[model samples]
Target: MSRHALGPEIHAQGTRFHVHSPDADRLWLCLFDAEDRETRLPMARDGKHAWSLDVPGAGEGTRYGIRVDGAYDPGAGLWFDPDKLLLDPYAAAIDRAFVYDPALAAPRGEGADTAPLMPKGVVTAPLPPVAAAPPLFRPGGLIYEVQVRGFTMLHPDIPETQRGTIAALGHPAVIDHLRRLHVSAVELMPVNAWIDERHLGPLGLRNAWGYNPVGWFALDPRLAPGGMAELRGAVAALHEAGIGVILDMVYNHDGESDAWGPTLSLRGLDARSYFRHEPDGRLINDMGTGNSIDCNHPLTQRLILDSLRHFVSAAGVDGFRFDLAPALGRLPTGFDPEAPLLQAMRADPLLSDRILIAEPWDIGPGGYQLGRFDEGWLEWNDRYRDDLRRFWRGDRCTLGSLATRLAGSSDIFGEGSRTRTVNFLAAHDGFTLADVTAYAHRHNEANGEQNRDGHGENFSWNNGVEGASANPAIQAARRRDIKALLGTLFCSRGTIMLTAGDEFGRSQQGNNNAYAQDNAIGWVDWTGRDREMEAYAFALAALRASQPDLQDVGWLTPGDVEWLDEQGQPLTVAQWEDPDRRCLAMRFRRSGLAIFVNGDDRPRSFGGVSVPARTVLPIPADQATA
Candidate 1:
């Protein structure tokens, strides 16, 4: 019952494609030449819902699409309206914008109206035509997490049309800012194709963060002006600026979502095999999104591996930050350190050399596997975030905790090397450095989830004021605390990640979980520049750049780093255990570079310690000794 018959002769070779509708009665392969005219080539249907059309000149710079015919069942997850054009999951470059139309989601039932919820089909541009080879800068990389749209949309200098697109990120003004900031890597939030949650769309909100992924190989047309071409151009621009690009990828689950979710791309193609299901054919909800991908399965693994290969080989991405990485390693029983996906990535020639960052936790049982990752992987140091927050917030019993975290959390990561940890005080998901010292609790009513969306245990102190205030004294205290946190993050022995707008004191107006608030709340406010915040950020970056000890690869031990009391002498057991004695000093040297950290809130005037005669301490302008 296939629509197109196999041609008498196989004239073309080395041309291939895929079709998702296995049960379809018919399928057709349509191609357009460089002039945008249809060639209407015939296709041979394979047994497994796949189709092939071989045309010698159709190899590259050719535009293609698939057409299918079948029953359109909305509730049962089968939306096979052949009348509607579909995009190929493996498309190297997308060409057009997704025009918003409700007819695309029209229900098949008689008299049923479906004009409001339909998403438009995006066209893919040919590869190599949209390809660019961007150079990589891996070693000594400083990652700055940012959102493409949010980063430039409000910037006054960016052109009106260029704002909120990948092209905007490459603007000379933007590039100059990044160069001045001294960040070597820009870890962009998820740019993979995604669907706005139905609830959000109905409520006049959008999935601003792009965490809900639908197509791994495709770039979200929403973030690009000329589709994937703009993305490639942006990467090339960043490379010209001497900055590497790291994408935040979500492979644990798809945007098709749980049972109630729509049949957009992968789910409609192969539900049972692609997704982890229950014994009764129900969806597995390990990701808290109604379905978890069966990464253990070969086909599913190939999907993920192919997606990664496409990014590196086709899109020119330098690295990836796996979101909810623990779920990818989960087996039927529990989490496996040597999961096939992990092993494959570690062994893959293309991926091994690039940076691999793991979020390291999910919502599943026994999900928190902090330090269990392999030697080559870098994990987000959640414990460091917690311990630093506690220490600066003046929580009781935090002095002991601070020491362990400052030494790279040997308790969590073991006492081998500190490079495995990615020390950070704040990231995209939670409070900014400014908000951490200004808000006591999350005010997430703006998220429309009844203030129950974000984390409850923030371990944050507002320094006596819940939110922003005009009081000079309170503002000064908050500014000092912000500097202290930045100092701790950069001074710690591990890879450091600074939130994008935190350098200039960006806040979400107390909305810790601003995933859905894509407006000014999420955008980087370039207009509002705080002199204190800028000075602190620049000072920390300069300090880290100047000191080799802060970025050391070796681990600290009792024999190397000695903790001293305020009196310039080593601490005793009783003094070390005392809760009220908040003041402590640490001295350590790495690669012949030495450093000392004073943890007390008050200044500790200790006598000069012995050091090489030529050694000098690099202090900030305000703190320099005459």
Candidate 2:
């Protein structure tokens, strides 16, 4: 069962406000004026789980927050405190971004009124919904993962003022770059309003990624100075350029972190229903983010569904990439692909045909569900990422693993008629492609964690020297490896991802987990980018875009394709199991298109074609034999 619509509603005479707080005894509508004067109005209980009020004069641009008073037992998970002014979860816009303050997390009755410290939601008059259209993104196309501020912060062409904002992506330079890469969509990482984690402030660092979101619908004012308008305009521009926009959504958890974390939005209103809890009454941290949203709950499900629809109908975003997606499917027993919320998204009229991608893992038990999602959802295949890296790094027995990945990991997704894998060499969370070949380990000491943060086993290696090397020979070798990685990715059989600056040889020095270094280390250095690497990436994308065989989206069998050795002869069972095998040629029997890979230390010859060391070469002709 659904409750009445939440959030503020603007009418000709006045604005009506509604909220869902089934456990709250009373709720106050806290309205703030231009001079920051506060006015509180009591809301009447409408039905089972709603509290609403109508103000005759309160209309557009009215800044408001919710204050709920109820049981204050933290152990029981009821965190209602009237002093904690909360933003409406459905707040489509906010006056400013949230800043982390210790007072916001002070337990009930300990801290002074937090109204002054928190940002107030700005009431917005809904714009005409963006005209409905099908998503521009499709399977087997490039999904360029992007961090809005970091991606364009250092671009010389963008104006100084708009350099780090979302609107900068709409500029001609950005679109031209996307067009060159043949990007199907740009996945904007967490653009919603977020607060710096409490620990980051003391370290003189902040959350560079907006993963710690507070409100679901409101855009972070830092990324979008003009609020929803900024996002809407950018989406329109990208759509005009034949590119899609996919927002990286975080519904698994809210920024209102742990038991000691802030009482921002969901916590103060209805923590019991919004967040999952154990029998002893502790917050469940399946997402490893302190608190997990109880996505199975009807109220929580409704809130998430409304937010997804809001982005689609109001802002015209093409799709979403769910973060820590296992949390979205977890039931009381375990994660289920057919969980109610997951099914609801596919069945919902507004989202049925939308592009849905899942990160497919978390920190909880049974969280590593690689190919478990239903047929409609494409999953980020870490197997492909790791296998390809191992093969290129000269790991033994990786040739067969590389072949399995190139053929769309049928062993993983054999049940489906087509593969639902999103293959990639590197992503935003790890080392960039350039760093993958140049740094053997993570140097995230700049993150203020004493190099203690980030993954230890990266499966990365230095070509000859670690970090930045002045040796031209070392630099040239790294470039060759990067191009080889790009070639393998583009020639693979499923949809692929290229972290925004990865194609152009962006290096974080050696920082893999750069979620805090918002300075030069995190920003893409456009001026220093390798033009040759950029050209190679563009050419590979063009090839993938032009060829139908690479985009077949089906599982390749022996009849459909053949694997050959360096001499271009069919591989024997013994050769297939050889640990030192370094060359592979996969030819589509129907299209007669072959991709020759040379992972060895020296050049390898395939028929008349000579493939350089650490490279992948494509022969488009029907001459299948050497």
Candidate 3:
């Protein structure tokens, strides 16, 4: 038996499986039947660092784990405790969570005193039958980014056990809200199996956002209380509600982290081969983490492709958004558009119709390849976020930039389908919509990294007061600004992604970077809703759903949109270039819907200067047309 024959492969029946631990003096394959009875099977030593075992009638659904013999050196990144059974990296499903055990920190077979503190990996039953594929959604799809845990964790209407699990997202209450929101896709934060940072673990904090990925092929046991069955059910429910699920995947680095990080999985198996190491054998730190994965390697590429295929064929996932996507495209001469991974994805039969999105940047050299991706892919538009923030905050000389962004950032994305731009104002990484207007600076003392962790160039305003205040004028101004931002987001000619809880004015108490705060500081406080915010959120949702022109998937011609000045006349050179001139307008007609946006802070009105006189004005979906 070898590592290749352990899991469910196309030719899994009657296959022998084995694992090789070259550094270990001894190793044993622990196999279990469907009844959870374990048997210690001896492994035969094959030449050149290989071990093998044959298990008859041990196909899919048979649970298995391994025990490796080695020293427990914390400084050298070897944490091998035979007593603490380790999981197979290729396990189809994990049945239980890892409990904190201090004994796991000690060397194995030394003393009984260190036995009780070690965490043990529990074997899971075979995976359930693959679910049927959901109805296919097209590109130019509107995605609402959300956290599976936070969406239902505090919802008063959801059941207790179902709360914060994948099954809960499919509840009628949740689906109804999504239908009302009218987004075609729900881009979930990283649900791939991940571990909280060791620093956060000691502080009793967790990585609530799930960006740190440990296993790309497995679902996080934390999010699937009922196991893979529950995840499948959630996906089915989303399909029933006409919404698709897009997973945010991390491929730039593994959870093994830096030189001093844990080696529970891949790095321990093949350190020199799995990760990119420097000339002196030091791990490459391109991801700002301890180690960057060697995506250029053929085996590594296969693993990624296998993981993606598993998610689509087994888990019923509809799409994927790659985190720090530039790392996936990095070759010898910077980011290569024809990287094997990207090309395989485009050519793969299973992934051809799926929605592909890229974060488009990393910490590596020559990383910001914004519009350099292929035509089939969409990119998270950071330019749209910055320019929109600047325009609304009254930044000088931003009118030109704002116009370019509002028209789909043609400067960055050249000539392509308008849907290539995934327009967003605030994402999970930075300030929430409320914080963008309510905090002038980041206050990340809650993250336990002092105030030095999050980004400093926020381009935010306090509306005359930082944080929260009871001042009526400031509060009113904040509400108006929020409405304007939402209006701009929905009116823009591209796919829109609204962060969850932003519609109700969710805030993190000025903690712009609360990545490690698993507590209420990062949870959505549904109790904080005000009448104005609630009404505006509903109105914005309704408007986005009702406007065909705003949601058009086609590209816009020069004559399709006309820029206007404050006095209803065409924009002049002085107005377009003036640093002080913040007022701007865009009028477009498509798919029987007309859209007009006034980006100025002050109130301005427009008349019938271009369109048909008897054309009907589009009303909100929940409102009646006059």
- Collision count of model 3: 10
TM-score of 1: 0.86
TM-score of 2: 0.98
In Å, residue 320's CA in model 3 sits off its true spot by 0.6
What would the per-residue lDDT of candidate 2 be over residues 411-452, giving only the tens digit for each residue?
887775332889888988989889999999899988888998
Evaluation by TM-score, superior candidate among 2 and 3: 2
Candidate 3 local distance difference test against the native: 0.71
lDDT of all predictions: 0.70, 0.90, 0.71
Top TM-score hit: 2
Which residue pairs does candidate 2 place in steric collision? none
lDDT (C-alpha) at residue 550 in model 1: 60
lDDT of 1 at 531: 62
Q: List the residue pairs that clash in candidate 3.
A: 1-17, 1-18, 1-52, 1-53, 2-17, 2-18, 61-126, 101-117, 103-117, 258-290
The candidate, 1 or 3, that scores higher on TM-score is 3
Per-residue lDDT tens digits for candidate 1, residues 512-623, read: 8888998988888888868667876786677777665566544457865666665658878787777666656666633333344444555545445322211112343334
Q: Which has the better TM-score: candidate 1, or candidate 2? A: 2
2 versus 3: better lDDT goes to = 2
